[model samples]
Target: MAGVAVAAIPDDIAETHKGIVQLFSSTDDQRSVRESGQAIAALDESTKARHLEMQQSIKELTGVTNRMLDELNDRKSNLLDPTTKRELLAQKSRAEDNIRRMQEDNASLQNQVGALSNKATDLTTSEQQIKQREINEVKRAKHTISLYANISSIKWDYSSPNVKGWITAGAASTGRMRAFEMERGSHSDFQVVNHLWNLMDSV
Candidate 1:
C-alpha cells in the first residue's frame, strides 16, 4: 500500500510526500533477515522430506527382507514344486541383497538429517504433517513384496530361440515383460540373465 501510494502520487509531490510510506519503509538489514529466513525454511523442509523418503524405503525393504528369510526357511523344509523352488531361491537372493542396500541407505539419510538439524535454527517443529503423510504412503505401498504379475502369460519352451526363450510381453513393453523365473527382478531384463545362468544347470 505504501509503495502504491508513492507511485500514485505525482512526481512534483514526491518530495513533499508526508504519508507514513517514507517513514515506515523497511531497512536493508531487516529485509536481509526476512529473505534469508524464508530460504532457510524452504531448504530445511526439502531436506527433511528427502530424509523421510529414504527412511520409508528402508523400512519397507526391511520387511521384504524378513519375508524372504521366512520363505527360505519354508523352502528348507521342503521343495514342493521344483520349478517354483528354484525361482524362490533366486528371489531370496535378491531380497537379501536389497535389504542390505536399504540398510546403508537408511543410515546415510539419518546422518544427513542429524547434520541438517544442527544447522537449522529453531525449525525442528516444521513439516510434521508432511513427514507423517510420507510415512503412511510408504507403509501402504511397501506392505507387500513386489512381483511382476504378467509372468503368468509367458510360456517357456525347451527349444526357444534365445537362451532365455521369448516372452509375449503381455501388457508391458515388448522389451520389458520377460518369461523368466520370479527370482529375476521385477523387470524382465534381470530375470533373463538369471535364466541363462540357472536353466543350463537345471537341464
Candidate 2:
C-alpha cells in the first residue's frame, strides 16, 4: 500500500473528496479540543500538587501549635516569677494568633481545592464527551468507507413490485430460471423463488 495513489474513480471523485474532507476535518477539531483538555489535565495535576503542599504545611503548623500550647500549659502549671509568667502569656497569645492565621489559610486553600476539583471534574466530563463524539465520528467514517469500498458489492434489494418484475425479467435472471425450474416439482425451486422474494421484500 505504500506509495500507491488511491484515486477515486472520476465518477465519484468530487463527492468522495468532499466526504473525506468533512470526515477528516473533525479529526483536526478533535485534536485541538484534546489539546485544550490536556492543558486542563495539567492544571488539575498542578492544583493537586499545590493542595498536597498546603495540606502538609497545615499539618506542620498544627503540630507547632500543639507543642506551643503544651509548653504554655506547663508554664501555667509551674510557679514562676511574674515577669516569666507575663512572658509565657505573651508567647501563648502569639502562638494562638499564628494558629488562627494558619487555620484561615488552610480553610482558604481548601476552598480553592474544592473549586479546582469541580473544574477538573467538568474538564474530565467534557473530554470524555469529546472522545465519545470522536469515536462515533470515526465509526461513521468507517461505515462510509465500507459502503464506498463495497459499492459494487452492495446488495440492492428491490422491494417494489415493479422493481421485483425487473429482478424477475431482467437483472436477477436467476429468479426467472427458478420459475422455469419450478415446473420440475423440486421444492428447492420454490425455496429459491422464496429467497428472492425475501431479498426483494428486505429492501
Tens digits of lDDT, candidate 2, 1-203: 12223232355644765565557567758775566556655765686677667667777787888899999988777646787779889999999999999999999999999999999999999999999987886567447534532532223323532212222333443434222122222334336445455543443
Span of 10 residues, lowest total lDDT, candidate 1: 1-10
Q: What is the TM-score of each candidate against the true structure?
A: 0.26, 0.34
Per-residue lDDT tens digits for candidate 1, residues 1-203, read: 01111113346544533332334344456665566556655765676677667667777787888899999988876688787889989999999999999999999999999989876734554567678877785455333212221333434554644433434434554445344434322444454445544543333
- Candidate 2 ranges beyond 4 A from true positions: 1-82, 152-203
Clashing pairs in 1: none
